[model samples]
Target: MRLKSVLAILLISISATSCSLYNKLVYRIDVPQGNYLQAEQVAQLQNGMTPEQVQYLLGTPMLTDPYSSYTWYYVYLQQKGYEDPEQYTLTVNFNQKGTVSDFNLDRPLPQQQDADIKPLELENNKSWWQSMKDFFSFS
Candidate 1:
C-alpha cells in the first residue's frame, strides 16, 4: 500500500511537470523570410498614394485598423519552438488629406512578447523560477 501511494504521488508529480513543460512550447505564425523593408523605402511612400500603390511597394498589410483605412499595420514575429520569439510591428497612419501622418516600428506585438516571458535587458536577469518554469513549460 505504501509503495502504491508513492507511485501514485510520483505519477502525479510527473504529470504536473509535463503539463508545465508543455505550456512553454509556444507556437506562432512563422514570419516569412527576406521580406523586411527598409525605413527609407517606407518613407518614400508619399501621401495621396493610392492603396494599390502602397500595396505595390510594401505588399499587403497584415491588417487594417478598424477605425479607418488611413491606418495600416505590417507585422513580423519569429520564435523558436521552445525559445522565446522576437517580434516586429510597423504601423503607418495617414492624415485626413491622405498623406502619411505618422509611422511606428516596434518590437513584436506586446501581447506576443509579454507572454511567458517579460522583457529584460539580460538573459541572466531572468529569474531562476521563470527560467525553470519556462524550460519545463511547453506550449
Candidate 2:
C-alpha cells in the first residue's frame, strides 16, 4: 500500500513538472509561401511570349512591381524549423512591347535533394520482429 502511494505521488509530480518545463516539446510545421514551380515549367519559357502565355504556363506572379508593370517576380520561401531556410527567386522582365524578353532564375543554395543528406531521426526505427515482440510484451 505504501509503495503504491509513493509511486502515484512520484508519477504525478514528474508529469506536472514535465508539462511546465522547457517549451521544446512544441512541434513546428514547415512554413512555405509563394508560387511553387518545377524545372520543366521554367524550361518551357520562350522569348517573345505574351504575359497571358506566361501566366498560363507558370500561374500568376507572386509579386508584381507597382512602379513597373512590365516586371514580374516569382518568389519561393520555405522555412524548416531545424534547418536553414530554403529559397529561390525568378524574375521575368518584359520590354515596352509587352512580351517575355529575358528572365533569371537564381538558386543560391542547391535543392535539398541535390545533396545526399538525410533528416534527423528523432525516434528509433525498430525492425518487424522487434516491433511484434514489443507489441506482444505487456511492459
Candidate 3:
C-alpha cells in the first residue's frame, strides 16, 4: 500500500538524517598518553647533574629497565583527533658513581631566536605614523 511505502520512506530518512546529526553533535575528546616534556626543561639538563637533580627537574622517568638502573628514559606522547601523535624521548646514562655521564635526546631542543625578538622590539619602538610610513615606503 502507498501508506506503508510512505511510512518506510519516512523511517529511512529519519534514520539516515539521525546518523549524520549524531556525528556532528558528538565531540571526540583527544587522548594524550605518556609524559610531556618542554624544551626549556630539557635545556636545564646538564652532563653532571645528579639523579636527584634530574628527577627534580624532569620528574620521574616514564620507562626504566630493572637491569639498567643507571639509565633513565623520559618519554612524551600527545595524540589528538585524526592527527599524528607528537613524541620525544630523552635518555640519561649515569656513571658507576651515580653522576650523570652522558645523555641522548630524540629531538633537538628548540633555541630562542634573536631574530624573532629583534623584530618585536623594533615594532614596539616604532610610532604609528612611522609604521604607516614604513608600510607605504617603496624600499
Candidate 4:
C-alpha cells in the first residue's frame, strides 16, 4: 500500500514537471496572411498589353514556361493549420507577336520531370581500378 502511494506521488510530480518543460519548449502557432494578387487586377489584363505593362500590373510572373517563352505563369502557395492551404495560379499565353493572346486564373499544368544535375559524388575518389575501368570502358 505504501509503495503504491509513493509511485503515484512520483508519477504526479514527473507529469507536472514534464508539462512545465513542454510549455517552455513548444512555440505558439503563427498565422500567415494569405493575401496575394487580386482577381479584379488580373482580370484587367487585356490581349494587347505588352510584357512591361503586364509586369507592372502583376509585379512579376513566377515562371516562364521553358517550352514557350511567350507563356508566363504565376503561382503562390501558403500552408498553415486546420485551414486548407491556399494556392493561387495564373497563366498568360501570348501570341508569337509577344502580345497576350489569352489568360486564365488557376489553370492546371502538366507534371514535368526535373532535369537538374545531381551533385558529383565520386568527384575526387579515383581508385586505380576505377581509373583503369574508365580508360578502357570508353572503347
Tell how far residue 16 is off in model 1, in angstroms: 4.2
Candidate 2 Cα outliers beyond 4 Å, as residue runs = 1-25, 108-139
Clashes of 3: 0
Error of 4 at 77 (Å): 1.7
Off-target runs (Cα >4 Å) in candidate 3 are 1-26, 108-139
Residue 102, model 3, lDDT: 94
Q: How do all models score by TM-score?
A: 0.47, 0.58, 0.58, 0.51
Q: Which residue ranges in model 1 land beyond 4 Å of their true spot?
A: 15-53, 108-139
Question: Which lDDT tens digits does candidate 2 get at residues 1-139?
Answer: 9999999999999998888764456776888888887777888988899999999999999999999999999998888765677788899999999999998999743434746777655346877678778879997
Candidate ordering by lDDT (highest first): 2, 3, 4, 1
**lDDT of candidate 3 over 31-133, digit per residue (tens):** 7666667788888889889999999999999988689799988987767665677777899899998889998899874454567554334567888889889
Colliding residue pairs in candidate 3: none
Candidate 2 pairs with clashing backbones: none
Alpha-carbon local distance difference test for all models? 0.72, 0.84, 0.83, 0.75
Q: What is the lDDT of candidate 3?
A: 0.83
Candidate 4 Cα outliers beyond 4 Å, as residue runs: 1-35, 107-139
Models ranked on TM-score: 2, 3, 4, 1
How far residue 102's Cα lies from its native spot in candidate 4, in Å, is 0.3
By the lDDT metric, which is better: model 1 or model 2? 2
Best by lDDT: 2
Could you tell which candidate, 1 or 3, scores higher by TM-score? Answer: 3
